[model samples]
Target: MLIATWNVNSVKQRLEHVLRFLDEARPDVLCLQELKATDEAVPALEIEAKGYNLAVHGQKAFNGVAILSRFPLSDIRRGLPGDPEDIQSRYIEALVSAPSGRVARVASIYLPNGNPTGTDKYSYKLRWMERLAGHAAGLLRLEEPLVLAGDYNVIPDARDVSNPEAWVEDALFRPETRSAFRRLLGLGLTEAVRACDDKPGLYTFWDYQAGAWQKNKGIRIDHLLLSPQAADRLTGTEIHRHTRSWDKPSDHVPVSVTLDI
Candidate 1:
């Protein structure tokens, strides 16, 4: 089975790109971030028409997420637990039952992009990270295979981003954010892409401004972190850079990991 994660930026604007990637990559499951669309506007029927099950958690115009899978998705849940006041549609999880009827939990998350990191948004980002750590702890106890994949927004290390210096003041690069990520990963989870790839220059997101994609300046903020059961079955990983080359493409590309469980 192939599991992939992509930050589509805006599903409404990049619906074509999503369809194209689906046809090309044919991942068994695809997690999306930054949908920027309301649930009613998610084009679910169009996606289902393409032979996939769909689930979306979206708000008005920002920080939405969704999951598309060739297999059936059950026990769908929207938003991360632990905060009733948290209204952002940034986290969605479901149980994907494959052809063999074996089910695995998968989550598509979009961590906050707390830019100019000295305000309430930054604080919210930190708090959100804490909530995620707590949520991950619960998943760890499930014993079933769990795959948490998404645009974490926090760069794990200098190797994950092209220029460590340029992002010094960025929220995504803050030591606190990275430490939060480490704490989450400390829940006995493994980053599938990092586990399979040995090189550093492989990035998933490039800024549209400053000709970042053209200049090949990018960051691997989007990721697939797997539980022990899921990681043990990892077969291959690919960063589909060609998707970023498409016309009016999203700023981020898709990263896929194949598993042979």
Candidate 2:
């Protein structure tokens, strides 16, 4: 099955572009982050008209996430389980039952940006990462085929960013943030893209300002992490660079991975 993740930036503003991409790409399952809409405002009917079932967890004017799938989806839950007080439209998960009867529990997450270090928001970002690690560890113990995909808002490494020095003080590249990210990945979860390609310039997001996309300056923050079972089935991984060139495009583009079980 082809499973893809994208941070659409804003679902309402980029509805047409998203629709166009869906029609063209036709992935078996699509995960979205940064929807920046509310549940009542979600374009569910429009998306359903496209012949895919939808699961959405949205907030107002900021973070949100959704999952669209052609396959049967079940056991859906909104929000991360570790923190009840943490209010952010950042997570959604569901079980996709494939034709072969294999069920893969998948989550689409948008991690905290935590810009301007030494602030409460920055501390929240680190705390969020800790929660994610706790959840990921529990999921690994389940030993089920699981995939966590989305915009992690982390630079990951010097190679993942276009300008390493420029992002040293940025929340995405801070030592604490990077270490937390690495710890999450170390929980017996495989990063699908890195498993296939280690190239330095494989980025999924660029800033809307500073001519980042125009100058091909970007960062790799979006990711697809898989459980052992899912990792074993990974066949291909790709970043749709062309999407950035589309009309009314999001600063972030889609990243997809194919799997055969």
lDDT by residue for model 1 over 1-261, one digit each (tens)? 888999998998999999988998898899999999999999898798889999999988888999999998989999999999999999999999987867789999999988879999999999999999898888888887888999999888999888999998999999988998999889899988889887889898999899899888898898888988888888888999998889988888898888774
- Per-residue lDDT of model 2, residues 1-261, tens digit only: 889999999999999978887898998899999999998898999888998999999999999999999888899989888878978889999999888988888999999999889999999999999988898888888788889999999988899998999999999999999999889888888999999998889899988898899898999999999999899889999899899998879999999989884
- Please provide TM-scores, in order, for all candidate models, with all chains considered together: 0.98, 0.98
Q: How accurate is candidate 2 locally (lDDT)?
A: 0.91
Candidate 1, overall lDDT?
0.90
Scanning candidate 1 in windows of ten residues, the lowest lDDT window is 252-261
lDDT of each: 0.90, 0.91
Stretches of candidate 1 exceeding 4 Å from the true structure: none
